[model samples]
Target: MDPRISKQRTALVLDQPFFGVLALRLKVVEDASCKTFWTDGESLGYNPAYLGGLNDLETRGVLAHEVLHVANGHCWRQGDRDPKLWNDACDYAINPIVLEAGMLLPKGVLVDTRFKGKSAEEIYGILAQEKRQKEKQQKQQGKGKQDGSKPDAQSWQQSASQPKQQPDSTPGGSSAPQSSNANGANTPSANPEPTATPDAAPSCGEVRQYTGDDKALKEADWKVAVLQAAKAAKMRGALPGALEAMATDAVEPVVDWRPILHRFAQESSPTDYSFAMPNRRYLHMGLYLPSLNEPAVGDAVFVRDSSGSVWDETQAQFAAEIIAVNAGVQPRRLIVMDCNTRVTQVQIFERGDAVELDLLPVRGGGGTSFVEPFERLEKEGIRPAFLVYLTDMDGPFPDEAPDYPVLWASTTPLKRARKAPFGEMVEVIC
Candidate 1:
């Protein structure tokens, strides 16, 4: 280990343990061929000359930058995309975060404020869109010249008078010129520009593509490590406010709610084997086997929180999933109940009847109360196979868990969803 790198890692450990802890996970190796610094999700590679050019603060920043690329899973995220562009997008997404931590990155590194709070995927979309648009414009210009058509006077003058912008080297050690257009248009020059030399490029570092069979395992390990680092930082009162939600998400990962909803419905439905009705296919083969029969998924109750907290779009999405699940399970009846403090509207769909969202009544703008739906179910003498409640889980709960299984499809933070008195809780991402 280089003494300077070792000293800065220690400095990070004392000041920013979250970054410091993650930084230690990457084994540092000096590579003369490396332009500056880079990480392959597991190890950090750097050129000795790069570190020697930076002061202590900038060196520490470079280390944290690489650590974040690993911690944020950027290396494993570039799937089938142009590698250079993906690297640029990842740099845009994380550079602001590094700068916000009050660490100094060497000048000329990619840092676009436009992508400050966006994820790498989101930034990639914008960059990809810009690239496509620019390519289209260039293609049109080329066609015009081939057709012997002259460019408009203003357009020709603008092109001739505009000073050529030199390509700026990204932290990834590749030359990607920063867009000078105020609108953030990243247009490449039609003619190739000279690539920046290694010595002249910024020392902000690079994130290499993670190409290994254990990508999922590595990603899961990083998530757990992030949670642990966050805990350690929190204990020392050093956790950044910007990272609080990220840490919380690490603690309770956000997953697609559709599969979870489907699983809950499937598990809660009744199943039995009947010897009276032998399997016809097996009977033809002279093998007498008991027929496995799944009873019609009995009445499924869907309770919607209509207390003005949940968005209409979220309800529509939840309703669509419920209908899809119902189609799969073929429930005998689907009872849609819109409730707040009390059950406001009820729409029941009997077996063989079309279940349509347009027919379902939407009502209620009162306080939230989970007790009303249960009370209504009891009053109607309708014992459902399962009940799915879509809410923010910011309401009063029933005194006891009901006999029937309950699945809270909550549209709140996982911490709040965990407060549900009973049943399984899955975060409903809107």
Candidate 2:
């Protein structure tokens, strides 16, 4: 009834050195009658029946494999790949490393000699090529249907190692032919159109994830948790070189646009006073009024570079990014301005108000010039904390940089060749 509890006890009793700490970090849940063990970035789902036969070492090894899955972000990295193949490729890359680290995988666990030392990505490519070849052969024989698109690259590593183990669907709706060394867990087939999970935190390697079921694992920002756990493991001399090398990328992952925008808003030094926040000193004297000092909020200005290149889709995505970033900063007001040859339209909203561009009117579809927007701001005597210019950096610049900070968010391929005369540059990858 409590197989996960038993596994934890085993990890503590037989392998307290490393697994003890790792077990504590992972959220382990029990599924009494499942065919395999699995993890969904947030929690490790275990089937007691599948694990009952393994000894303590083997059990610990299985547990480690699941942890490695979450740590390595295999769950999130499956980007547009076949789930079965992605998992297999991940196992191929991780299993050998696990065995080398002294843990023991159960017998019959998939371990290919050819994929030795290759990354999941490299292996996935090989597997994908094999799948393509097989698909081509099947088509020639008139035994299969073509989807018009190429076989998924993510399937590359999975099928390369095991071309014959086609996933057979079980009556229970789960796919059969379990992912190689996916600890024999039963996984659902890949979605025809696999997209990243919305609101799913960037796989930060964190230990917290809310699975909704209180009995399940809690939610967290994985990026922070993974980095912290790795650091802690290293400090305790428990982190393996293999794991360290894998975690290095997550520790210093790409600079996210949200943080960049939030920081831009945060850098503002607001001096406005609000009667809502009365001075305590004056309140004691029976006088409640707006404080002369201590501003609780600031304004954010978004300058839209509405050139022909900035398509509708790109514009909407940029607006969403602005809303998300502004939500984090909790600014007092938001002003959206459109500029192509010049500032064409301006819409103002309060902090919590929704800025829906579709409902509002937008002006401008002319040649681009970065000079007009700043010039308009100066002419209008509007000094926002900072200005976020959403553009492709394809226009003439102002003679001098503005007094306030500016964030040049571009979507052009020639980013490096183009230059912003001043202000930080953030690539807006929509």
Candidate 3:
């Protein structure tokens, strides 16, 4: 090594070879005429167009929002999933945290807008009305950059990306996560939002107990409302569901998924990642990435540990967002692998299309392992450029993971991956 060689000068270095599983190197374009923030696997496109440079807090929130996407498995989760749908899920999924952290939304998208009409900056009241009241009543309270933008003392703080310290759990709740999978099935729970706000009439601070007069949007109708909003955001492009996402609802984070590693010693986060109706799991589940890009279409097949229970709706949305991101990149090929076989793959799913990818492979499994995928890829002569092996920290990995990049997304902060050589690994709670 050159005596004076700097880490910045070195193209790549790793704690474990497999840890760096991402395919695109981010690009940074900063000057007078650039547009809004967008990413290709390799780089970023910046706009000097906005004259106001971010103040430290604003900058951190914006960065946190983007980083949260990568850390949350928002990118890879979209494998063969519909892009638009998945992105819509994320905007809704991360809304609480983003708003809590102070990311402001456009003027009218807030769900409570029809009522308040932007007169009050009521923090997270729209999302968790009771929570806001409780916190305000309590009078209690509550990182920065490196890379293309410029490195600073915050460079060291980037470690804050996934803080070693656990975050505060959901307000006014017990330690137990609301529900868990039973035999590879979806466990239904009332929506994470506490079943009170979906129909927040023009009242100040009332937690409703459905009256005979109760009239809420039908589930199908609510879905349509959400879609109409997401479509309005997506057609304008640039992060898809941003407007419909409603950044005003007190983005304060809820549960941080990082604790499941040790907190649920008897159980494990599911390796089978899927979308459920929103839950309190996201705040803790957040991850921070600098950026992401599209790999060549079919260049990689995202395999799921569908052996465990799954979040059906959330998983469906995960698939959709990936499509949204990829649609922007226009990958050369796209292949989705399930435990059983490939289905409805090779083509991108357009929004509103009734997509039914084969789900057989998602079933017929009890335990977990990485072997089936090695054999699958080998059968196709496809050596993945990198792999994101999401797991629950309970299963043992292959005696050897191929010499490629792999991030171990396990429940708790990762300890040691016994085997799986060469690839970079990250522990993500499923």
Ranking by lDDT: 1, 2, 3
Evaluate candidate 1 by giving its C-alpha RMSD to the native, one decimal. Answer: 14.4
lDDT of 2 by residue, 288-310 (tens): 88875546566678888654445
lDDT of the candidates, in the order given: 0.75, 0.61, 0.34
Runs with alpha carbons beyond 4 Å of true place in candidate 1: 150-203, 250-279, 282-430
Q: In candidate 3, what are the lDDT values of residues 1-430, reduced to their tens digit?
A: 1111112112111211111111112234454443333332223344443314434333333333333343333443344434433343344454444455335432222132122211111112123333434455455221112243344445557866754421112111111112223342223323434332433321111111112221222222323433443344344442223333432221212243334312321122122323333344454577332222322333434555443322333234335434443343333343444331111112223323455433232332343455666666667687644444443433444566575445444332333233344454444422
User: Which candidate ranks first by TM-score, i.e. highest?
Assistant: 1
lDDT agreement of model 1 with the native: 0.75
TM-score leaderboard ranking? 1, 2, 3
Clashes of each: 0, 23, 57
Which digits, one per residue and each the tens of the lDDT, describe model 1 over residues 1-430? 8999999999999999989998899898998898889998888999999888889899999998898888777887777777776777777767777887788888877765555555666556556655655687799888788767655555689979987532221111112222213432223333222132122444378889888899888888988998899989999998877666556554455477899999999999999998888889887789999999886788998998776445555677888887887788888988988876667778888878743434463576545688989988887898999999998776788997889999998766465343788898987754
The deviation in Å at residue 375 for candidate 1 is 35
Error in Å for residue 37 of model 3: 43
State how far residue 321 of model 3 sits from its true place (Å): 3.7
Candidate 2: list runs displaced more than 4 Å.
Answer: 1-18, 113-118, 141-220, 254-430
Off by over 4 Å in 3: 1-298, 340-361, 411-430
